[model samples]
Target: MKAKIKATWVSVFLLIAIEQTIKIIIYNNFFDKRFAILPPILYFEPMFNRHYSWFNSMLKLNAGKGLHIAVVVILSILVIVFYRFLTKRIGSIKIVNIMFAFLFSGAMCSLIDKVFWDGSLDYIMLKGFFTFDLKDLYIDVFIGLMILLLFTKNEQLKQIDEKVLLKDFLDCLLNKKHY
Candidate 1:
């Protein structure tokens, strides 16, 4: 258990460092300079994103930084809370540790970007789609791995009762049980 926790923290910090370092390097050298990596498909153009998320930008919400930070905090809290349910239902497996580390690192990086970089330091742009940074990659990797895990662990996951799990999670959240 101790080893797992230590490994997870180390991985999270390493990922966070790598993501922030790349963002800083691109911010200093490639900010606003567009170069076609793959013509009409991909490009590198570093810039600060003022919008909280792509959804916000797509909808032109222009949500304030305070709201963005608050949302991130809430999301982070949810992740931590969800972990108890995850460990209880699936057991503390290595892949679970890896997924949570990626998620934690990504969320922490987003918070750092908001507080320090003024927003996400987006550099990789897909033609007409959107621009994103390494933090996004971390989250994407976590999501991909989770999907793969679900597919591979379908039988194991199906054995768990979701309603009871939800009730337990809520009980933990309401301080009725130790998560």
Candidate 2:
């Protein structure tokens, strides 16, 4: 289990490093260049997102980097609490670790983007919709797997106590409990 957890972290950091490296390379060398993978549908076009996500931009959040980082931190806290809950309930299952890793990596990448990049450097464009980057793909994996788990691991997930999870998170934030 420990090995699995270690592998999860290693995989996540590798994904982050690779994704960010690609983003940085493209941003540096081809910021305005667009290469069509599927012309008129999908393309790799760089975009600098000052907001955290497309949802935030669409809603016109326009929040400062400080606020963005704060939100990411809070999200990360929630993710950790939930992950700890799962580990306690089901042990360190690899699939669960991978699932949480996706969420964790996405949050960490977003936090990094806020602190260092001023915003996310999105390069994947979906015509008539929005542009996203690799971090977005990481988040997407979590969402997809979570939905699948909701049905497949329904019994285990049903053991989740929302109230307890919330309390645990609050306790951690208040330094009243150690996670």
Candidate 3:
């Protein structure tokens, strides 16, 4: 338990550090510059995203600053609720713990941007698709993994229980045959 807790904290810190470092470097060097790596596929075009995900097109809403603050607050609350729920259910599961760490780290990374930069530094673009940052990728990947874990957890546990029951039944049969 202690080891898992330590590992979780370390992972969260490392993820946040890496996300911030990449964002800072891109902000300093690639701002307003578009570097096409794969012509029409992949490119680096740093821009400040002042809204949550692709919601910038929704409306002016509460100005950029207010929107950023609201995003941060909402994400923070959701992270807290998720952590509590996961802890209550299967906190000892290694994959679940790692998933939560990534999720929390991603949320914290976005929150940091909202609090400090008033927006997130988005650089990677898929031409006609969308633009996102490392933090966004982290969040996306972890969310998918968490969903997978949740879906398969019951199956895995049921398999384990079945195996144990089978073993016990075989043992009883062998003992009766010996007798």
Candidate 4:
């Protein structure tokens, strides 16, 4: 358990570091610039978004900075609580743990943007329909993995009846036949 917790923290930190580094590079070098990367399908266009998942824009909330910070803090607390609950109930499954790390890291990236930049730097444009960043990718991947885990009916997953020791969990992850 200790080892798992350590590994999760390391993963989270590394992800956040990489995401922020990329964001900084894009902000400095590519702000207001667009480059065709596979023209018409994908492009590197930097954009700044202050809203939370387009919810504020879709609803035309026009939320103030204070309100945005307050809402994010409340939601972040709730997410942490939910994450803890899930971890307690599901033991230390590797995929689930990795998903949590990604989720947390993505949230942290956005939070850092809100605090420092007032918005996140989105550079990956898809079909000119939408723009996103690495943080968004992390969150999207986490959600997809979470849905897969929820729908999967593997016996090994069901056999995780109690909290697993870190060594056993790592061993199981390395031993693919167990799946």
Q: For each candidate, how many residue pairs have backbone atoms clashing (under 3 Å)? A: 0, 0, 0, 1
Instruction: Report residue 124 deviation for candidate 1 (angstroms).
Output: 0.4
Candidate 3, 86-146: lDDT as tens digits: 4443345677677878888888987788788877888898888878888888888898996
Report the poorest 10 consecutive residues by lDDT, candidate 1: 84-93
lDDT of 2 at 116: 87
Report each candidate's C-alpha RMSD, comma-separated, in the order given. 1.9, 2.5, 11.4, 8.5
Q: Which ten residues in a row have the lowest lDDT in candidate 4?
A: 170-179
lDDT of 1 by residue, 50-164 (tens): 7868778899988888998899999998997797567765677788789999999999999998888777889888988898888998999999998898778556566878898
User: Relative to the true structure, how large is the alpha-carbon lDDT of every model?
Assistant: 0.85, 0.83, 0.73, 0.76
Ten-residue stretch with the least lDDT total in model 3: 170-179
Question: What is the alpha-carbon lDDT of model 4 when measured against the actual structure?
Answer: 0.76
With a 3 Å backbone cut-off (N, CA, C), the pairs that clash in candidate 3 are none
Give the TM-score comparing model 3 with the true structure, all chains together: 0.73
Summarize candidate 4's per-residue lDDT along 1-179 as a digit string, tens digits.
Answer: 66886798899999999999988887787787788988869998888887755567568888776777676677666566555555654556688779888888888887787888887778888984788889989899999997898789866566655455444444544673232
Q: Each model's TM-score, in the order given?
A: 0.90, 0.85, 0.73, 0.79
Error of 1 at 79 (Å): 0.8
Q: Which pairs in model 1 have colliding backbones? A: none
**In model 3, how large is the Cα lDDT of residue 41?**
94
Q: Pairing residues by index, what is the TM-score of model 4?
A: 0.79
Model 3 ranges off by over 4 Å: 58-64, 150-179
**Top model by lDDT, which number?**
1
- After superposition, candidate 2 runs with Cα above 4 Å error: 153-179
